[model samples]
Target: MNTDRKPALRLENIVKTFPGVRALDDVSFEVFPGEVHALMGENGAGKSTLMKVLGGIHQPDEGRIFVEEAEAVMTTPLHAKARGVMFIHQELSLAEELSVAENVYLGELPRKSLGRVDWATLYANTDEILKRLKVGFTARTRVGDLSIANQQMVEIARALTVDAKVVIFDEPTASLTDAEKVVLFEVIAGLQAEGVGIVYISHRMEEIFKITDRISVLRDGEYRGTLVTSETNEDEITQMMIGRSLDLSRRTARGEVGKTALRVEGLSCGSLFQDISFDVRQGEVVGFYGLVGAGRTEIAETLFGLRTPSAGKIFLKDEELRIHSPIEAIRHGISLVPESRKEQGLVLGMNCRDNITLPQVSDLVAGPFVSDGAEVAIFDQYRDRLEIKTPSWRSAVGNLSGGNQQKIVIGKWLAMRPDVLIVDEPTRGIDVGSKSEIHNLLRDLAGRGYAVIVISSEMPEVLHVSDRIVAMYQGRVMRIFDAEEVTEDSLIQAISGIENGKVA
Candidate 1:
């Protein structure tokens, strides 16, 4: 793979800083043509800052950027694009209200006779790119109407449209289903065949191993080391990224299962799910196992009052409840830590203090307004408990690392002191250490007499964390088994439509 080809992009001695934080310190790396260079780091490890500098969003205090063997300086995003550098951000950048074609060609639309856009050319070109990406939607489809997976494809198509040379993918597979991830890997393969230099940033170790040629680790704003993907193991990369090995063992049940904290009877949400029934005990973690489109998230959303159930009845302590909205659910002591943290969980513009106390605003309010002392006390308590590493509680949540941002979302719900907590994909794009921390936190929550529901696509996580597994397939409850009864292979088979009787 290494033909001594000139690196497509290289950085020499990069340095960047923010208020009170030396965000990047003398970082350096090179990504060659036809290579997938993974960028690995824990939260606050300067991964984002370095990428921003590469994308021309942040000007490095000191560094040399070379593009295609030529020294180059990216003064603006437009300049980077002109240099054939494309950055697909972790947070999507599509204009939701516009069509996929329009968003793809945004700010650089084709012109015809200086009067009108060349609509025919735009659609044709976009359609070709969509076909290449194996996207199931047309370019004429509105961006807002597309699912997160499809929206991501549109972003990829936009990067392709420019014929990019050096492409940066930031957590590109975070929201994708397994099937969708396969398609994305195919697209990446196609790009690689063209000798495109790729900077792939992902928290999923498996993805990094599967797709990357080499990995560059960053820790605390300093360059750690780079290793060939084939030569280094997960343990080595994880240690380099986090400065130590994390204890990833799943905690057992805190005590004997208490009374049933929540139960769902005949839960049906149209075609999303049907006749789903389950009971979660007070001191138990029930893991929902299913693939994409298997109605797991739908069931969680329905239970959290984000969606209306058609024929289901929910009981808390054997008492039926009519929860028509999220407010009602929260009022009834049920909370959901949603999958998409940035869009649904926390307001990025808000500070940790406000975000953590958002769910319990009513309780924190005295007379007419919120009591700052009360909010501060709650923030301080959970901040220490959760180990949210932030310079200040008032710093914007968006500025925090992905792990800390996720903690803020969890903190927001923990403040509610809910009897039932549902966490969906809690560690989606988090580092291994962060994932372990969040998993332990969930176990602790379940230990505290709260029924906890964990919905995850990760087989290892589900098998390790849950006392019971509810396997769903094609919108129906396939089977429910004790954690001891289902091995990883068996559970995966059950979730993939194999009968429980057939599974060992």
Candidate 2:
């Protein structure tokens, strides 16, 4: 609304499609010079599709793009760059083996008159760019050795190398810690000061409120609305994004703690965790809350037989059990939906249907060959149950977005019909609607008498879904609160060891 400011880029009536799905339809928005405009939407809500169109990764079937009020055609990434548009992808794309300086100046490296690589000029120039962004890592260091946060900083530095005027960042803070997020905010502010128009995309509400000046929402491949960040609350934006008021209130009145389904006595995995103990009963959801390295995941891995407990006993239904591998755990009706969905949960090369039936494919098969009809029928049930958004079961699992891939993982585990289901970060990188569906699915599992163990860093999720919460600190069971006694404030005090600090 500032008359003094000129618009840097504008997208008018963009339309794009692939196969049977129209990924983007008549979407329009504008980015002003030196301002942060956020693109907010559900996973398949046309946000990614619009960005790809802008970056020339995909040409729009219909629409117009303008730069500085002049019509422009961007048919390739280089063309977009020529108009001063740079895009940082959500998936980290730095060459791990290359040095930070080398990556910063990768394609457009400074060269001598004889056409030789100018290492000295590259390092000197990259160092200045890194310093301007306040990145502490040495430019000469290999990017693979740096943390995820630092690696992202290197990617941003590469953008500066291009002399980019309009920068688009997708899910920039998805992996950053709280301290790292602060550093990123400072960097973004610095870029804005330099008159770079920035388009930021993320699902974290607090982040959008903090870093964005204007917010745009897209739903089902169409532009929903745009709002000024100063006048909006999370509920208002969420309503526009999801097209309804969200019942985020998740405190359930659990009937009673039924018979014990899982019992771990004196569980230990050497130095990872020592003398851990817990009990999970039927129709109960128990949450494990901890920091990154507090050994919460290690405990889940041990229980699922990914790691062997140095000394402990696991009992299911009052019968002692021995779990030496994931297969054995599955056979004993214990399943794990691991944290890293791509690396551990689903096979990217396979289709959604195959990924769902991977665990118990043999059971669905007849003779020595897999029954194609039986496989399709079995997968269709889960695909429908999980509300997976795919044109067909034949769609490659890798092609689906993060939330859809997560549903496939959940479908795979649910097909196993496990007595105890352990899920780690169930809603990470997913949208509000998908998150609600997943939560309902977990509750349904618990209602059907399955013992569910959820591990999450989001306090709202833990407090909402769990019948009883277990707070893990320094690899020990620091505190446990029943459903009736747990509140957001109390849970924070228990997990952080700070009772008087501000939680709300």
Candidate 3:
């Protein structure tokens, strides 16, 4: 794809600092036109900070930016927009309260010569862009009512509307499905045909090798290296990102598995999932594998007492549980690491120490006063355990990256020392290093005689981490397999609902 053309965007000697952290230091990279360049790195390795500097959200203390062959000073997002630089963030920027057309042309709405809003022109233009992407959505659709995939497509349409020269996609497929991802790839191909330079940031290795033409690795705010995609392997790129290769192999329990820690019989929660029965034993890990709407999350929520089961029985140590709230579940030594950490897990306005200790406030109480020293001591403990990278315990949870925030969520529940731990998509947005750490930690917890249940959409993750695999489809249990008996193909078939020659 290299055509001897100058890079569409270039950053030279870029340096940015945040208080005590040097987010980026002399990090330089180039993105050529018609090329898909992947930015690879672990969390807190300066990938997001570097992208922010390019998008004009953060000014570099020292560096130069070049658009094509000329220098450009991007002091604000609007200035970058004028230079044809667009960013599609993982967390979408669309206003959920507005219609699709309204969000598309929010600031630069079409106006008639009579100083009135041109409603017809706005919807027409939005429709044209949607059709161009081959996406099935109307301009009048409210963003709040749309799925995550549709919302992503609308974000892409906005970039194309601005005629973006250098477009950056940050973890774009974190919430997309296989079918939706295919459409996204097609759209990217269209952009490539138009000679648009793309900077893609994702933790998915398969996506990198499938779509990227070249790859660049960043670590600790410095440029590590760049490799041609065709000549590189996942191991090599992963090493460059983390300074070492990570191994997430099939693991066995260190000690003998114990008795049933938790059991569910005839668990039915309305139409979400029905007749679900499973058991988690001490020193064992159970993995629930399914697609987005396949009811895995609903199952986990019910176990955590966030959802009321209509007809079912939950037993802990063979004793029936009448749980009606999260407080009760935690009181019975059950805790859930929720799926959406930003929304369901942590309180963003609060500091890291407080969020980690929020669920265990009772543990830190001293009669009429909640102890600050207790919170700080607990914070120090988890900070060391999780390797959470922040200036201090006083730092707001809102300011940390997604990966770090997830660690705080995990730490919050771990502090409870629950007998049964249910983690829903525990490593959703975490980096490879953090993921490996969490994976090992889970295994350790089980080895220490705690029950662990992991629910994930990633096939390899489930296959590698779980002692047993529980496959589900359309809110029904398909089958369960021991770790050694499951293969990726069989798992995919089960997840896709193609069992016993019948597709459910």
Q: TM-score for candidate 1, please give it.
A: 0.96
* Candidate 2 per-residue C-alpha lDDT over 43-110 given as tens digits, one digit per residue, 9 for 90 to 100: 88988889888997899999999888888889998788888888888878899999999888777788
Candidate 2: Cα lDDT at 48: 81
**Candidate 1 C-alpha lDDT tens digits along 1-504:** 584988999999999987788999999989999999999999778887898899888899998999998988988888899998999988888899999999998988888996699999999989998998888899899999999888988888888888788999999998787888999899889899999999999898899999999999999999999999999999899999877887655434446689999999999989999999999999899999898889999999898898999997999999999888999999888999998898899899999899999877877788898999998999999899899988778989988887889999988888888899999998888888788888888878877888999999888788768889899998888889787677767777888888846632
**Model 1 lDDT-worst window of ten:** 247-256
The residue pairs in collision within model 1 are none
Segments of candidate 1 deviating more than 4 angstroms: 249-255, 500-504
Query: Residue 274 in candidate 1 has what lDDT?
Result: 95
Q: Which stretches of candidate 2 lie over 4 Å from their true place?
A: 1-4, 131-136, 498-504
TM-score of 2: 0.93
The per-candidate count of clashes, in order, stands at 0, 0, 0
In model 3, the runs with Cα more than 4 Å from the true position are 252-255
RMSD of 2: 2.7
Model 3 gets an lDDT of 0.89
